[model samples]
Target chain A: MLLEWILGFVFLIVKLTIVLIILLTVAAYLVWVERKLLGRIQARYGPNRAGEFGLLQPLADLVKLITKEDTVPQEANKGIFLLAPGVVGLMALLIFAVVPFGSGVTLWGRSIPLVITDLNVGLLFILALSSISVYGIALGGWASNSKYSLLGGIRGAAQMISYEVPMGLSLVPVVMLARSFSLVEITNAQSARPFIFVQPVSFILFLIAALAEIKRIPFDLPEAENELGAGYHTEYSGMRFGLFFLGEYITMIILGSLIAVFFLGGWHGPLLPPIIWFLLKVGIIVFTLIWFRATFPRIRYDQLMNTGWKVLIPIALLNIVVTGALVLGTS
Target chain B: MGTIKNLAEGITALLKGLATTLKILSRKPVTEQYPEYRRPLPARSRAVIVLTRDPDGEERCVACYLCSAVCPVSCISMQSAEREDGRRYPRWFRINFARCIYCGLCEEACPTLAIQLTPNFETSGRDILKLVYEKEDLLVNHGGKNNEYNFYKRAGVAMVGDKGTQINEDKPVDLKSNLP
Candidate 1:
């Protein structure tokens, strides 16, 4: 029994280390991919100087950020200013603990789960953690002692808070269809077919809500660079800003994973390992997100709010009712 | 019905924009990887100013102050000198390229075709004084736009040879021979 416990702990630690490294590396490289794809979309060549197609750009950026001066505004709230970015990074990283990349494979005659921890309420955990990241943007913006940051913070907070309602509602149909809150169970339930096909309305609603959740192109009023001069992190420099950036990309990846697990049937494909399949699905989703960015312009703040409160929420709620009725009638 | 049609049109329009960008994305970029691959500029394109020579290997400039006077930026300055053969030239012409706007105005004002703008516009330098081109630096061996046409050749002047020997000349109107 002790040996089993020791092995489990060691396995958990190993998976944790591997996941953290993979997550951080993928997040960094996502920035490069976005720039390259955006450049291609705009008919230009993106960063190809440093180490063959700018592969080392993230490392260079990390070094520059580390060497930069850490500034805290004199009149700003020192404590929250220092703490906010960490909150963003930590919450983004934490959500992945419940996300299963693949099914178990026998190693040394012991079966192990692929994810860090299989939380029973994995879907709820993701929603809660993602909602918590709003505090990071809010506190960072509020503590900056600048008008631009303050306005950005207020808009970001309002947008995030409004979107969370629709985002949570859209996932109701997924949860109902899966008949479980655990992401692994959700993926397993889609063995016959993915929930996207089963619930197309839910799929569409979830995608829009998730995009807003990540503050992407159409919903990115908070950090609308042209208007707010970087919004929340206007006063932040060095690794603090890096943390916010890292957190944002990590959230993108996490969102991709959640969407993959809940809607696209995670790790279910032919002629490939489950982990590879999971990665492939997430890549497709991430590519779609980047494509959306390249295609659309940022919506106005009022429009973003209207879309969330009026359009998405109403549709999501109606989707839940119909999905519930269908599931009940079929069962 | 109107709202539904409008929504459909809006979606179609967005899809069209995306399709256009995607098509462009597949096409090769028009970026001119400058510094490595310079594009061929037109011959008449105004850029760096240069002093051209006459066909007989002499300075074609009459040191006329027209270029300096017409220059909006007043970047051109020179001293007029007279040769032993009664030819006028700029003794020491200087153009502060730092101030030259490459507007081709100087080229237009030059009656002698001495001043001309070339397509070689890469005049960037770290030091400001280095861009201040003197006569020797600005002078080029070629006759620029009018390679064969020397200014004093047909200007009713006695610079190179006697005025009657000049091309397209009528021997100074010939007052002694005119009867009609």
Candidate 2:
């Protein structure tokens, strides 16, 4: 029994290490990808200087961030200010623990799941963790003792909380159809047909809400750069700022994965390995997000609120009701 | 019905915008990498200043002080001195290119066409003193814009030749003759 426990512990560590490394590396490269894509879309060659096509730019940026000074504001809350970026970074990383990239595999007479831990209430866990990450932004801004930072923090808190309603409501249909809170079960339920075909409304609602949740373009009022002068992270410098940046990018990837798992039928495709199919779906979603950044203008604050509260929430609630009825009738 | 139609229009507009950017993504970027490529500048483009010689291989500048007087930034200065052949020359011509605005006013003010602007504008240097060009640095062997122009030859000066022997001048009326 002890040997079995030890073996399971070792397997968990190995999987955790692999997934963490992949996530960090991919997050780093996504910055390069976003820059290059945004450049190409706008008729410019972005960052072709560091190495071949600026593949080494992220490395250079990492080195630069590390060597720089970690500054703290003179008249600010020191402890929360220091901890804020780490909170954001840690929460983003933690959410990935429940994300299943592939089905379990049997090796040496033992079955090992691809994900770190297949929590039963994975979706709620994600929503809760994301909600908690709001504190990171809010506290980071509040502790800075600057007017711009405080305003940005307030906007971020309000926007995130408002959007979470529609985001949660949209997922109700998915849960209704799949009949389980477990992500693995949701993926299994979609082996025949992905939920996107049945509930495209939910997919769209989730997408818009997810974009806002991740603080992407058109919904990026928190750190709008023009308005808040980098918003919550105005006082952050060096690797602390790097931490906020890393958190943003990792959340992007996480949201992409969540979208893939929820809507596009996670890891269930013919003529390709499950993991490859999973990655391809995530890649397409990520590219689309970047394309959205290039194409769309940032909506006004009033418009953002109207879209989230007035339009998205109503649509999502209606979608859930309709989906629940249809699911019951069909089942 | 109006609200529904409005929604349809909004969705299509968003899609159209996405399509436009998508099309641009496939096209080649217009960025010209500097260091790797340099475009050809026009010949008349004003840049670095130079001192040009006359077609006879003689210094065309008479050091008349007109260019120095006309320089708005006071970048140009020279000490005028007469040579052995009664030819006027600058003893120590200097142009503080650091102070020069490259307005081409000095070029316009130079009657002899000795002081001219060149198309080679890459005069940047780490040392401020290096940008202060002396007479030797500015002097070029050939005429700049017009090779045939010899200021002394056209003028009524006796330095190049006797007054009547000049190419474009009529024979000076003999002062001893009582002819009108």
Q: In TM-score terms, which candidate is top?
A: 2
Q: Please give, for residues A87-206, the per-residue lDDT of candidate 2 as tens digits.
A: 999999999999999987888888888778988999999999999999999999999988888888998999999999999999999999888888988998899899899889999999
For each candidate, C-alpha RMSD in Å?
5.6, 5.4
In model 1, the clashing pairs are none
lDDT of 2 at B179: 86
lDDT for A180 in candidate 2 is 85
DockQ of structure 1: 0.47
lDDT per residue (tens digit) for residues B51-153 in model 2: 9999999888889999999999999999999999999999889999999999999899999999999899888999999999999999999999999999888
lDDT of 1 by residue, A11-63 (tens): 88998998899999999999999988888898888777668889998888899
Under CAPRI classification, how is model 1 graded? acceptable
Candidate 1 Cα misplacement greater than 4 A, ranges: B40-180
lDDT of each: 0.89, 0.93
